[model samples]
Target: MHIVFVFRYHIFFYTRCSIPFFTNDTFETQGRRHEVFVNKTIPMVVEGDDMSAYSQCEIYKTSLNTSYSALNMPPSNTSTEQCNKWVYDSSVLKDTFITQANLVCKRVIARANANMIYFSGKMTGALVLGLLSDRFGRKKVLIISTLMHVGGAFGSAFATDYIFFVAMRFIIGVSCTGMYSSSFVLGMELVIPSKRVAASYMLDMAWCVGLYILCFLAFVTRSWDMILLVMASLTVLLFVCLWIIPESPRWLKSKGRFIEANAVILKWETINGKKALTDTSSSKNTKDDIEPESVLKMCTIPNLLIRTLLIYLNWFVIIMVNFGISLNVGNMDGDLFVNFAIISSMEMLAYTFCFLLLNKTGRKRLLVGTLFFCGGACILSVFVMLFFDKSLYWITLVLSYIGKFGITASHSIIYVWSAELFPTKVRNSGIGTSSVVGFAGSMTSPYISDLGKYVHGSFGEVLPQVIFGACSVIAGMTSLLLPETNGKALPETVFDAVQFGKKKADDRNSRLNCFYTNDAFNKDELTGEV
Candidate 1:
């Protein structure tokens, strides 16, 4: 199941970064804001002005009969016209949909729009399919989502029209969310409490491995369509494994499907060489007495409102910062493929460290620490870029990578922590809701990365980093309010979730009072009080 899930996860990052519009540089005409070609250099006029330095969208409406000497001078009173045709630089990225569709200048927003639409689809899927999983079964939703994902991937690969391509990306986004949320919940439920953290880290590590595979595929194929086709073809393998994976016994038991749940447990016991439970009569084939709770219950229920909001905020901030840096890889000073590969590798390194330290440090402290570290690194990079020379740009890049490492670790920790915070009955719903909120961050990330181009000077280069840094720091401070969930059993009900951190707080208060009373008594004895 992990292997299959990893294969499916490969599409997520590829979809985010595969678009060439974000990476390709546009060519502008000299002294003009309009009419320009990409990649192809225009002949320079004798007046020391490069024609390529004109407006990207405007061009002088000059006649062929105009003398070469006139071309040397700026067009005085000559009408400027919008550029009708565009050619993109094909040196780094060849045969991309962006070039094929000519999405440049005024049409460039379409690229960001496509990505936003994809994330919106993911947001929709998280809210809808997450509830469906809790109401139906995880395995059922997983299979259905897997089918949708495969179809979407295929559709994206073969889409000829821009509208069709964006529509297909939307489907891929939604289906990917459904597949991940369902599979993640099921995997978490199957693991014992002691190893749940380890299980969550392993799943994320698999996701990183999938990213590595994606980088390799992108390097080899170098075409968006071919990469999609290849990944889609490989996704078919998940169906084979899906057949063998069992429905989560925890979910089954929570729904009061005891007969099926017990059967699954018995199989596990048998495999482990333990005697099966002989009291089969106790396993009644009936629904649970308690009604299933919806994700909305978290919002309406007074005890859960604050915690839910905090989790949602953390999700939004982490995702925004992480994807903000990731999607902006092209703007960095290095080979695009190598930079992407390095970013992906950083995630793997983060997961490795997360797996090693998660159990030891606990969830809350680790999340807070990583968020702060990421925030500090990002802000420090901005300072370096602002105060230092261009030669020191490499230092900025290294700081940014460090920031990426911190955020990636925080991302992993938050996933495990958020899952632990929710109850089993509404776990998928809770996670789905948080993910839906997070997608909003993902949607805005591209535009945030583009902020550098709009702003002027070195500050422009560091603007996105500044925003990401501030958000991370704020989120880290906010995370301190969330309770730690280490070596604790998964919550099985709303009440359990409500009381998760309160009990520990109460215990600490009682202990403090006890210590004060004992100290007073000792002082009285020393003073010879009766």
Candidate 2:
């Protein structure tokens, strides 16, 4: 009797949920409905016995010998207003900025412009906050950035118009850059040189986890306003957590606050279960004895200038290709949610793979290889799309996934590489400059992805793919000029950066031995006098 009751309940539930409602009389009516333009006005065609209003309208139009037009119709000045309506697939996003702003079809450009504006703000923020972090302190800058982000997120959720929403996104973008740059540099400073890769991996892991969590939240909440509010609250909560963390010891020492630096180091030593260094004077001597140089010197020196330029260029290309692929995933012909989930899952796997190979393969080899791999896959996906039938869509999807994996892994490597490439004094400056320049790529990436629509009449959808792939390939070859800093100590001064990769084998070995023997003193050495 219990089994019979459970079976009946299951049957009833399925029958109730599976019942279909037909807006069009025939199931195949979906394929026949079309969008037509009459006198520069576009409207959706509604047909079938189920649509009585549309059928009546058709009879009225035929009786008057006039065409059916959704737009440019006579205005109804009564108590109610009537306008043409569109049916949008609600599974992908319950409500997006575009949907809320009423930016459909002809007004789609506005949505793209909003995305571009946010990245432009990121460029401005990188320039401003980079210098602030160096001069003020990483922790302070991080806290300020977080507060700004929280404020921007809240502002965005309550935005009254499309322009207001765009402006808020720009504000959020600015704060995000500050938080990103400061937190990364600070995390690197807190760990040993050998363990920096592990530290970077942890940060990447957190980002990937957040991405998946966001997807789940969007699915559950299904409201753009609610989503933004939740994100803002979380960032505010993280700001409170930031108070428990200390300022970077290296940054403190750089500012000549030796006592505070030693206190922070001692706290770290206690946490690590290691003995605190008795000689704090050695750290003071290291800083006071060495003559500090100006940040401008990085540009004056030829080797430093060339290295900085190369790094900046590489960063720009990597980010361009990365975001290009990420944003375009929606345009691909598939279930939007499934494609996004697949891409996000692949990124997580890429981070894990990168962590495993980073120490062994070294930075340069991995960077060069991944760029080429990404570029090649992008180009190949286009080729498959053009030459093959629609039946082979899975092949194109697989190639795109491979490309995303390579780009994601490269992102992880570049952060650690850029931080190591610059000296302590100007490290933030270098990162900020590279990030600012890289923002150009991000700013243009939306338009690049949209190239398909503009040029699809002349060239096929392959033009955007060609541009994305070519940039990746070119950047990969150019990356060969970069100096390898895989297992080496982070440069502490402009002179240290100038001397990077120029040392003899014996000198390198000697530094490595000393680095291992006294890890605490080595920390002082890595930061260069500070």
Which one wins on TM-score? 1
Candidate 2 TM-score to native:
0.80
Q: Per-residue lDDT for 1-530 in model 1, tens only?
A: 11121121112121111212324434322333222221112222232112233344555556666443423543355565666555444445555676667666688677667777878889989999999999999999999999998999899889989899889888888888999989888888776666666787778877877877776776777676787788899889889989878898767766767688768767777776765432323233222323687778777766578899999999999999988777657667677778877888889889889889998999888899999999999999887878888798899888878989999999999888888898888999899999998988877777787687699667887889899999999999998988888866556666556656655434354322121111111212112221
Model 1 compared with the native: what TM-score? 0.83
Among all windows of 10 consecutive residues in model 1, the one with the lowest summed lDDT is 514-523
| TM-score on alpha carbons, each prediction | 0.83, 0.80
Tell me how many residue pairs clash in candidate 2: 0
How does residue 345 of candidate 1 score in lDDT?
A: 84
Tell me the tens digit of each residue's lDDT in model 2 across 258-377: 688788878877787776543445443454223454556788878778888888888898888887777766556666557667888888998898899988998899988998999899
Error of 1 at 305 (Å): 1.0
Candidate-wise lDDT, in order: 0.72, 0.68
Which of the numbered candidates is closest to the native, going by highest lDDT?
1
lDDT of 1: 0.72
